[model samples]
Target: MQSTISYLWHTDDLLGQGATASVYKARNKKSGEVVAVKVFNTASYMRPREVQGPGRQKVLVMEYCSSGSLLSVLESPEHAFGLPEDEFLVVLHCVVAGMNHLRENGIVHRDIKPGNIMRLVGEEGQSIYKLTDFGAARELDDDEKFVSVYGTEEYLHPDMYERAVLRKPQQKAFGVTVDLWSIGVTLYHAATGSLPFIPFGGPRRNKEIMYRITTEKPAGAIAGTQKRENGPLEWSYTLPITCQLSVGLQSQLVPILANILEVEQAKCWGFDQFFAETSDILQRVVVHVFSLSQAVLHHVYIHAHNTIAIFLEAVYEQTSVAPRHQEYLFEGHPCVLEPSLSAQHIAHTTASSPLTLFSMASETPKGLTFRDPALDIPKFVPKVDLQGDYNTAKGMLGAGYQSLRLARTLLDGQELMLRGLHWVVEVLQTTCRRTLEVTRMALLFLSSSLGTDRFSHVAGRPEIKELKEASELRSRLRTLAEVLSRCSQNITETQKSLSGLSSELLKNRDQVHEDRSIRQIQCCLDKMYLIYKQFKKSRIRPGLGYNEEQIHKLDKVNFSHLAKRLLQVFQEERVQNYQAALVMHGQRMRMVHETRNHLRLVGCSVAACNTEAQGAQESLSKILDWLSHQLLQDMTKGVQTSPPPTDPYPNPEPTDLVLHMQELCKEMKVLALDLQDNNHVIERLSRVPTAPDV
Candidate 1:
């Protein structure tokens, strides 16, 4: 290793070696510019004095073509099939330019093969293939001929192969057209990754057979034939699916291949023609090719005036996937191709990224997709106006659920409230009515005791209302009725504040009812229960000695008012929550109505695309069906218009075919038609020609 002059060089870092010179990678010390040096084999020592004596100059740092030689690239697993149309163009441009320069200076490259070609990365990141290893090249005119044969056996022309390999005694001079054959073979290997002609045995061992295969073929027929070890000859014209060339590029390339792959000297295209064709393709057309799977690939051509519709049509033609079946995506979101958008604009916008394709049947296509960020399916995005509704729906549903649940709990307690009210009414009726009956009996007894048959109680039945005690009872009844009437108010005692209010109720215990202890309330209830236990004992006890204390306790608690208050509490607790649930339910219902309206926009988008695709399918089907029907009608007319066979075999059905010639009793009739009619007959009959059923 040595760092000398203006560059650092390493002896072991050999780039490549040939019969004349060996190339090495080097770097300039001042500028740190990397370059490939082509040093003559004998001139191993560096001499920076002269350019011809071979001290090559480095202008700018060039990125080494990590792809190595064309041969190594073809041998790679990815290029096992070969270079696609785009990369193939790079090779064509470089070789044709190099060849043109060499030929213009009266030099011929006798050896033009994959190994002799080298590549470098251009400033634009495009591959720049260069024709290198010019050891076998020499100065020669177009008409001048050379006696010695050179080049790889597989890529060599038949004349050279026969003279060199077969050791033929005859001498033949090869002209400059020999290089054209080698270039043809090289281009074939570049595009397809294999030789154009092959046999069961190797090229050198099967010398005579290789010669016959090459020479016997017609001019410009570039189909490749390969003889397998145990199988028959396999000839193929279509390039492999792995070749990532666009449809436009492949179409342009086939003709170039045909013109150059010819054996006849007069038929091949010159370097001038090759350069123009490759240059036109590289500058004019912009085609993008995509691979979907191991087997499926598509090439979509883009142009200035083309629309999205035009672009999809090209995709459909190449991939056989219908537009409806294909789902394009951009930046990880579904890409809805806009019908009116310019395809060229989209292609340019997405030129830096790879595009991915998905089948309608796939859950979602993955990996990559090329799509413009601005492109979308119209109205597919969520509407901002409706977002509020969507966001609020869940809260409404939850609130409604809680409200209804609370209403159910209150309802479950309703049965208990009704039962308590019925008991309170029974207690009130039994005690009050019995008190009046006993007082009437006492009044009658007093009236009989007196001599004058007069009673101390002087008031009549209607006038009993005038008594102070009666008035008092009437006032209590009126208060209970008024309180019961106000059902909406929360009249029940507040359990939380009852402790503070209990002292007040105790101070005026006769007037105000407090929630007494269970023992106190139970004593009153038990006294009433005892009366009902015995049939005779169940009679009303009222007045002075009729269990007065028990009755007074029941009276003070105001059972009737408590029952009404309890019912009011139950109704009040449920009504608020139940009504709230309804309101929330109403909110959700309105949301559904609004959502349905938004869904119509989505449905319209779907329907339009579906209808368009269906219309196209229906149009094609209708045309095919119409054509079939027309042919059938024409055939039916022809069968009817033809003259009847005289030898019908059965002298009956005149239009029938006569198959039994021996049974025919008369001669057959023949019809002569005009030239135009004959052509029409041929056309009409061709549609229904007799064919074997598979």
Candidate 2:
């Protein structure tokens, strides 16, 4: 059956078919890229009936391997027997690398045999080997162990065979080391063209092979021959007719196989130990370092078997410099180590001398400063004062409300300014808290680092003395923060009280306005009634005589309608007044709250500054006393040239403290001015004339 999956890949050439799945060569219609797709036969596998349905078959898509499996290559007469040492080494390295990656991800490829390894042809006609068929791969849990026997019989570890035979409940479980045993068997087959452990008995061969694997030791030599060496006869495996390999290659293979085929699992060499033992097969490279002035410092050695990216990492760790900031030079010419470059290729090309590396910042001292021409200098924007904005809003609102257009303009402008002020207050509060945190940390660090004796010598210096004075300034800042905090609290409380007062005032205003509207309506109705009565009286006289009762009834109905209409208009006016009052009260309350938050933030800043100042003051006092004692000792030793006439231990007045108080007073004066201005505005508002009584 043929089908297209994901509307991108179409199944075409059939690759192979297995018991559980069928492999097909698929191609991407849009990209024209080829891939190997394995479609699992759900019927063959034991799955739940509910999961077994048409179009629900499991499928896996993978990158296509141009060359077929290693087993196919090994079985072929032309290539199977006579593999060169270098080609064999390449295959071994690739498989080991793949296994290392699996181990890193906590996976075990239990069936690591020749059938599962595939070769791919590169653009340059180079062969690259890759591990495939993860059907037997298992992800191990932290405490998990494998007990059941799985994988091909010949490649299985002796422990697994033993466990399967004994069928004991208390048998110890195996781990990823079993896979290493399978690798040993695969490598031996690839090198010698035969299985190390051959089966014998027809029906009971499986158990017989397991017994030999458990009891017998691996052959010590590679020639597959038995010879008398010294006192005992040693058995060895010789390469088959087509399996012509180098003595060096055979020597390397023998020890690795012996280690992996060890009876004890703990004695088996792991991936890390294997890699370390075989690292000499990989290439190497050298990196050199030089300063901006072309002065050489040191050189570093790195492996040239990986990509250029990996080499760059080694460079960074060696020099303690970031890769981005390093500039590589080869033979006085700049060279960029692109990601695509092969580490082995670069290492071969690099001269006997190391490649020079210089930091980007190094060029600045060589009079080669370069700035980005595209960047423009930024211009500073001046901050807008909320007080000024408030004044402008108040001025606009005070402009006569006779014109509806002007009234709307004033309201919108006032709202915009209020929003800006609210945002500014929030930012200020955050800044104050951050500043306090920084100051506290600095004071703690200084207190911990400097001793009492050290403080005296340090404080004696002019620069240090200036810093001490600055600490006093910080005390003033602290006081300012406290004042601001108090002001904020006061403003918040005042705003709450004012909000209640405004609500009450609004209710009173609404009642008065409603009463006046009703009174005006009643007066108008009374006048209309008088006019109707006159008209009726005139119609009743002499020649114009009419029904007086009818006229009276008509007048009553007209008055009733007029009264109803007037009441409705009055109620609408009352609603409008109530809404306007609420809007004004809400705006005023927000303003007060914003101001309160700003003051609170300023208070936090002051408190932090005060704490820092207190720490500095105590430190300075101790220093001064120490200095005085030191001076007295010098005088007793006749070391004094000219001294002050005052007592040696005279008390020095704290001028810094006095100055701090003065600064606080100055800030208080500014606050007082603002309060006075607010008081004037309140008085003006109070003087506005009220509506006359109905």
Clashes in each model (backbone N, CA, C under 3 Å)?
Answer: 5, 9
Off by over 4 Å in 1: 1-14, 17-67, 84-86, 104-106, 123-126, 140-147, 169-173, 218-223, 229-233, 246-248, 287-297, 301-346, 349-694
Lowest summed lDDT across 10 adjacent residues in model 2 is found at 365-374
Model 2 off-target regions past 4 Å?
7-12, 29-32, 42-56, 141-144, 161-170, 201-207, 218-242, 283-694
Q: All candidates' TM-scores?
A: 0.40, 0.36
For 1-694, candidate 1 gives per-residue lDDT tens digits of 6554666768798776654456678887888778765556544222223222334332222334555788877754335445756688788878888888988998888778987787767788988787766545778887798877666678887788888667787777878878888887898888866677776675666666677667765555665454665344454454543344545567667777777777776777776687687666555545443322211224454555778787777667765566665545333233556667877555332232334343323221121111211121012123222233222222222222222322333332222122222222222223223322322322232222221311112213243333334334334433432332231122111212223333332343332122222223234334423332321232233322447445533432343233233323323534443334334323332332233233233223322322332233233233333333443555567655445345434232322212121122111111111212322433333222110000
Pairs of residues at least 3 apart in sequence or in different chains that clash in candidate 1: 85-245, 355-369, 355-370, 356-368, 356-369
Q: What range of 10 consecutive residues in model 1 has the weakest lDDT sum?
A: 664-673
